[model samples]
Target: MDPIQRITTPTLDVLDALLTVDGPAWGLLVIKATGRQAGTVYPILERLERQGWITSSWDDETDRPGPRRRLYEFTPDGVDAARDLVAARPSAATPAPSAATPARPARSARPVTS
Candidate 1:
């Protein structure tokens, strides 16, 4: 895909989520991975497809009972581009600490009064 003009945090999140998967990923899987809403994830996926960064196809399996899911995967060039882009952004590589992780206390510049 031509270099993404608007690379927002949400877009990075989606790319990161896709990269984590070994194979093609579905819309709901992306949403859950990125913790983003359908409104956010679907548009990004569409944009990526339009840009030629990714391609999508409907799941062909008929044995399962649910609706056919659309699976998305990066094109060969897209994977290279995405990895370079994501690596350049250090913030995206480092995940935010969760509630279970202890927060570091801020060090005071001035001494505390007894």
Candidate 2:
């Protein structure tokens, strides 16, 4: 397994989302993308930053109050990492065919003794 490909579950999801978009995404966008709350999304984004898979900066243009919204973007490795993760997503489970459909082989008849 590639070392970077082993990124934690939440981090992988965040990176994949960032990779899909044309530019960086703010926290709310990430939240919407992953259906994850800020509590979960922020921590994962921090981890991705630490891993060097993604980078973030404050968005001064956003109208949000308090601090500028932190926007995230994927590094080259982040894109590669996302690709690996996507390739690794477990295939959807498929039900096995019914056993009843297979026919049993017929037994050969034995010759009768004289």
The digit string of per-residue lDDT tens for model 2 on 3-103 reads 45445567656766787788889888888988877898898877777878788888988565676788888778777867777666554223466798896
Clashes of 1: 0
Error of 1 at 40 (Å): 0.4
Tens digit of per-residue lDDT, candidate 1, span 35-106: 999999999999999999999999999998899999999999999888888887787657888999899999
Best by TM-score: 1
- Any residue pairs clashing in model 1, and if so which? none
Model 2: runs farther than 4 Å from truth? 1-9, 62-67, 92-114
Prediction 2 TM-score vs. true: 0.65
Off by over 4 Å in 1: 91-114
lDDT of each: 0.93, 0.74
TM-scores for all candidates: the values are 0.78, 0.65
